[model samples]
Target: MTYKNEQLSEEKVFKDPVHRYVHVRDRVIWDLIATPEFQRLRRIKQLGTTNLTFHGAEHSRFNHSLGVYEIVRRIINMFEDRPHWNKEERLLSLCAALLHDLGHGPFSHSFEKVFKLDHEQFTQRIIVGDTTINQILEKVSPGFSQKVADVIGKTYKDKLVVSLISSQIDADRMDYLIRDAYFTGVSYGHFDMERIMRVMRPIDDQVVIKSTGMHAVEDYIMSRYQMYWQVYFHPVTRSAEVILTKILHRAKELFEDGNYTFKLEPVHFISFFNGDVKLDEYLKLDESIVQYYFQLWQDEDDEILRDLSERFINRRLFKYVEFNPNLQMKEWMKLYKLFQYAGIDPEYYLVVDSSSDLPYDFYRPGEEGERLPIHLLMPDGSLKELSRHSDIVEAISGKKRTDHKLYFPKDRIEELEDKQLVKQIKQILYGQGEVENVR
Candidate 1:
């Protein structure tokens, strides 16, 4: 049998905590799962550094990728005999979904922010480059690898297939939401996923929910919204991320200085620190490898590098206070100057981090990074944008919310021998003995 038509003799099932079971019967899929590049995901965390915050959140990208694949598989099964669902693109969709997060590195956002790398770009490169994944894809047919890349890249001619993987309510988000919720042991990410899937209809170029499932869709949207604030954007988790990012920054700064002696050479990070990472070099660095480097740097001579490493390794995370950048610029500047005077590098010690999301939005022409809005397939076979049809959705749609926190080590500030300076700093962070938290 041709690889395209090949099926396994027996269905291989993975016992999944969230999906119950991920079934694999196709030989191509089974083979893709066994590829070295795909296996690399097993070493990368699904929620980078979040395990520190939520002890149960140690799940890996491999886990999330499989959930995505299974979701798309179930979706395709429902779409097999339905209109506007191209069965010809089934394998392409499955392949894209399975390998969608193939390029994520260890501590993905920190590395991306520090090195200016885009995981999605790396994902496409892995598919098209001279890798085993590319070889397996090409075995199905010539240029099949590129087709999968385009699907993941959102540049494919088949918009319906693209929507399955990249839309506002795609399989990726659906899987990550419930799966992250499951692993993190949170109740907020739970929603009527099965009902939403049941009512999904493949329109000309998008998937629309049956109006009967509008409530389920609203639940899903709210689940995503809450998950962001309560878990993904938890201040403690961001504090961990802040330290991780600062570690990378310090390493790169030391690398550029060109005179730092290393107890153990940062061979895995040399290319990343230089901002000229190749695919092979990129693949070699994962969470385990990065953690090893972080461990070694804990003993380094550079004070900033050593302190940040020890803090991250030993869980001495920074404490945060809500300081609105717009209104507190003067306060921030004063604190920055005081930190420098107190012998701490404000550039590394005093940092502000922000997270923002627009729960839902209808399309606005000529906007940057525009997200397509969810649509409801009305009873009369007409389409209506979700917000217009549901009061719950309308209330939150197109409303962008941002949360900002200034992260600093409260320990250092509290331990300041200059008690008067410590008092002054505390007053700015905590006005009237209470944090000015912005929710």
Candidate 2:
């Protein structure tokens, strides 16, 4: 036994676009990745319905997990000889970073929003509870699993390990920002990742960027802001979300009404409808299962369910126009009334979508800010908050960008037999009636 923990006999490599290749040296990390539960991430899309908007965004959570792991591996390599960076915690940090998104379910965000599920809690359950992940984690040590969980939960005592995974400018963000940009074919996410990696240093339990790399950090922050508005919060994506939400609502209502019957109870949906879901059932539910049910519902007797499912699956997304939350109130009300008159349900067919995100935020004392602020290490060994050092971060700090749009079935309205009514609705929506008659 010549220090067997050094490396695996057969090195494992996951082909990844973001990091090029995810290399596994420790047997523990290799075993964890081989677990069946981890394999399930292959089928779960990282961006979910965003693929419908960005055709190239078909990458899975498996892709992201490996990318995160690779970034952590590189950062830890940089910290090997540095102060405050423990060699003991190396595997734990990589494990935590890799499995952070393991608990994400199918269409995670929309599903969680509609059903009140927290993926983070589910993540802990999968890691510490009885499952392949738990077993794999326990292989390292009984207490080891909890340490990995704690790092992801952001409750770990080691500030350095927690910061690497959960901090504002950590491996998770770094991987996603770059990976998402590459897959979506956008130029905004092209920050100098190599420079950022080189600038990282571990100092007394906190990781900070070297002041020389402030420009690289600024580019990363700006890139994140651009991606949020350009891709993550696109109005079209929100429109699909609205439709998915209404689909869930309709299914729940039909279940409650007790008049309609489903071919199957859709057991996975039962808990969500009843507002109590179990982790095992949630884990079993992936995008394929959801799409399977949607396909089945297409043949259901409920016209609303069938139609909406078809729309979602077929990319018949609602068209939208910029809406003013303040000035469009009356117009929105009139559009609601007109929808009813035109036999379209305003609740399902007409929607106003609003999305806002803060790309960067400064520390606000006693406020509800969750993420720790990014810090840059000055030459004299003192740390400066990122916004204070970088002009790009200063410009975007604490400024939340918001976008609003009113979504409607442009196809339906265009083809509406009642041309005059359609004209009026179009006038209210676009401020003029240039809409062509539904041919």
Candidate 3:
């Protein structure tokens, strides 16, 4: 329980843009990050294909993970003598913060979509299984690894501790919201994090914002709302995702047809195509490995695979236009045939992309997967649900902001060799000579 034994011989610092610096004085935290498992994060992008849109968003999960750890370190510092927040829980929170994204693979969201892999499960494996993370965790105590894993799993029984890492507005979200905004260069994620931390108080089982800090809480909510629409749900990012999805689809088809011979078989992709990938192989993958395959596939004999990979790597993103979702089936068929007649592959080049997100929603009586409502402690010691207090949250609750876009290659259409067919297809998409401005 003494501080001297836990201190490192010299301070260690990781230069970070979000947290400014990730300082380490404990040997345990340092060793865990050095593990091959943790080092793999360097190859995994924090925002996935968002880089295709925001060129500056090339920061990795390694950056965000360290930022989260630093935020948790600060939160723990606020609890030095607070009730319900034992000083002993400090290391567990830090460990949970560092390992939260341990299982995230290359192009995380797209990979999870195609392979049905859960990064959370892999996180637990790295912590409790026979791995370097597990070994370092066990050094503190035989059962410490499980404890850290439980916190990440939100099964640690201490709601205050769980809230620090996994809450609706905890260290993870706080760090990422600002960190992502910083990298993406957006104004939506600038909240008063220092003020929020200053006002945080550990309650009976969960951490609550003090009544005096309600404005800060409202600012956080608005920031999240802006980020969800402005960055996380950007249409250009979705265009890249659409292209990535098509690439996987084409690769799977080639693998099935046996018409293609890869210079090297995408061994990592095989299990994904087969719908059963193992953890070790998943760990072996990162953005680099995926990009390596993408680079080689650009030369593939299969036109679809070659074209999709080229578009992804070269950032020839799909162009999008506002779409009407309630159109008749006949209209859909007409558009498909029009695209085909224009010599464009309707399957690969034409897509309808729709995205929806609710910034804040109060728990409904019969709602499933309902989030635990955020509460603000009133000056009189009574608690009020966030929506009941903040009109901004009330306006946002139950309102799902959705965007529908029809994607196509405008460059290809503009250069089409068949003038008449191009004219017809253009007419189907744009009534006369101009596309509809749905915005």
- The global C-alpha lDDT for each of the candidates, from Candidate 1 onward, is 0.92, 0.85, 0.84
Over the full model, what C-alpha lDDT does candidate 2 score relative to the true structure? 0.85
| Clash statistics: count for each candidate | 0, 2, 0
Tens digit per residue, CA lDDT, model 3, 111-130: 88766778888888778987
Please give, for residues 1-439, the per-residue lDDT of candidate 2 as tens digits.
3222557878788777777788888877787888878888998988878878888998889899889999999999989998888998988998999899998988888888878888888888899988988887776766788888889888899989999988778999889989999998888888999999999999877888999999998888888888888889877777888888888888889998988889878888888788878777777888899999988888888888888988998989999999987777877888888889888888889888888898888778788755568888898989999988777788888888888898889888888898888788888888884434332
TM match of model 2 to true structure: 0.94
How well does model 1 score by local distance difference test?
Answer: 0.92
> What residue runs in model 1 are displaced by over 4 Å at the alpha carbon?
432-439
| TM-scores for candidates 1 onward, in order | 0.98, 0.94, 0.93
Candidate 2 clashes between residue pairs 3 or more apart in a chain or in different chains: 414-438, 415-438
- Candidate number that wins on lDDT, 1 or 3: 1
Provide the lDDT at 217 for model 1.
Answer: 92
lDDT of 3: 0.84
Model 3, residue 204: C-alpha shift (Å):
1.9
